[model samples]
Target: MGIENILSVAPDLVDEVARLKSIEECKILKEKIFMNQLTKAEQEVFALAIDGHSVSEIQGIPHKEEFTIKNQKRSILKKLNTPSMTEAVQQFQNLHQEPSQKLIRTS
Candidate 1:
């Protein structure tokens, strides 16, 4: 049986499964970040972007010129192999979501 089927039969194990899944996702994200070899600035821009910050908002917080921030965002997208910021953010969110949350999304 699938994990979802098993989890459905035993709701009490849901929290433990979600917690372990979260830990595994964190490790996966860390590995991907490291493998991408993003520079510090690129990493910072990426984090801000995924956190829902617009370029203008990021500029004010990072004290960077808009042009520079835009460039870094572009670099981040390229490194992540995402076509756009929206896609990158979606992928990031999917990676961090709990198993139950993912099921809810599909439904």
Candidate 2:
């Protein structure tokens, strides 16, 4: 069946699907931003970090020296304007989150 047919049968499902698609699109855009802003090595380091890998674990990879990985992580933080890796990960997570899902802080 076509989307129109599906929408007619379940409007709420259509909305939810659209919302999910939008979230995916936003994530893609954010990823593209990272690609544009970071070098290939930095991207690799950042990806490992995002996957919960420690610097030592990243350094354990073949041909990936400890100093190189640490430098790449520092570059990532500088490029992202984040003070630490944890905050950089949080920023990435926030960028991937849907608008409605983000918490609204108030005084």
Candidate 3:
């Protein structure tokens, strides 16, 4: 269920996760989509969703209307190739395993 377990079971996913590095370049984003076939917009909207925004809140920050925000979310789900936003974001978060100092580790 943990990230290390995922990496062990599927190292390719780990390699895929490295694209999230802060030091990564914009060109890499293009490569990830054009070459690797990963969903770029899904990743962005996924991050926004993780930050706890309602569709209206998301629209506010992005300066888009609610319907547009909803459309973007739909597009994001399609690109991520998931049935829903929750599933896509959850899998992306689980797979990427963003390092957070604010988090407490019990293990």
What ordering of candidates by TM-score runs from best to worst?
Answer: 2, 1, 3
Q: How would you encode candidate 1's per-residue C-alpha lDDT over 33-76 as one tens digit per residue? A: 55366788887887887778876788886468888887888887
Write candidate 3's Cα lDDT for 79-105 as tens digits. 667897677657555533433322322
Deviation in angstroms for 7 in model 1? Answer: 23
Better of 1 and 3 by TM-score: 1
Instruction: Flag regions of model 1 displaced more than 4 Å.
Output: 1-36, 97-107
CA shift at 50, candidate 2, in angstroms? 0.5
lDDT of each: 0.72, 0.78, 0.57
Q: Please give the lDDT score at residue 73 for candidate 3.
A: 84
Best by lDDT: 2
Tens-digit lDDT track of model 2 for 1-107: 99888768797777677776766676787668766788988888888888998777888989888888888888888999999888887887777664633333212
For model 1 the TM-score comes to 0.55
TM-score of each: 0.55, 0.69, 0.44
Reference-based TM-score, model 3: 0.44
TM-score (C-alpha, index-matched) for candidate 2: 0.69
